[model samples]
Target: MTIAEVSEKFGISQDTLRYYERIGLIPRVNRNKSGIRDYTEEDCKWVEFIICMRNAGLPIEVLIEYVELFQQGDATIEARKELLIEQRKLLIARMEDMQKTLERLNYKIAVYEQVVVEKEKELKRSEN
Candidate 1:
């Protein structure tokens, strides 16, 4: 697919796609004779993987390391697994923290709701 097509299809900006290529986050995309990017199926897979990892809060450096390991051939399989395991742990921890924050926000919102209800009751009582 063309770069524009990939950008639209994936909901990723063209600039971000270029940045991913420049930073080696995803393997270099093949260019057509005109030097425009032509994303192959494999290239699109890498883009999807990187985008998912990024959404999961994986660090750019970690992803870059993973890609480097991937490029090093079969010898780095165990190393890549270990890296992914470590990153998964970190993501779990972050999710736990986010859950706690969500609970706190819910609690605060409930408190505000109760206060409003109490105020409404007070107004009703005073008018009676």
Candidate 2:
């Protein structure tokens, strides 16, 4: 498929696809006789994998490193696995931080609710 078709299929813009290609995030795409990009199923599969990793909050640098390792043949398989493990650890830490933040916000909201309730009671007493 063409760049436009791939972009539409993935819900991403053409520029993004080009940027991904430029940044070594995705493997190089084949070009037609007209020098237009012609994406194959394998290319699209790689793009989808990259997109999924990105959506999971995987850093671009890590993704780049992974891509490098990937292109380096099967010898770097262990290293790539280690990188993924590190990313999982970071992701877990991030989730923990978010949970702490959520807890704080919940506590603050409870305080506000109590304040509102007390103020309402006070207003009722004043009106009596």
Q: Model-by-model lDDT, in order? A: 0.96, 0.95
Please, what's the RMSD in Å of model 2? 2.1
What lDDT, from 0 to 1, does candidate 1 have? 0.96
TM-score of each: 0.97, 0.83
**What's the CA error at residue 126 for candidate 2, in Å?**
4.6
lDDT of 2 at 96: 98
- Pairs of residues clashing in candidate 1: none
- Top TM-score hit: 1
Report the lDDT tens digits of candidate 2 across residue range 58-110.
98888988998999999999999999999999999989999999999999999
- Give the per-residue lDDT digits (tens) of candidate 1, residues 1-128: 99999999899999999999999899999899999999999999999999999999999999999999999999999999999999999999999999999999999999999999999999999999
Give the best candidate by lDDT.
1
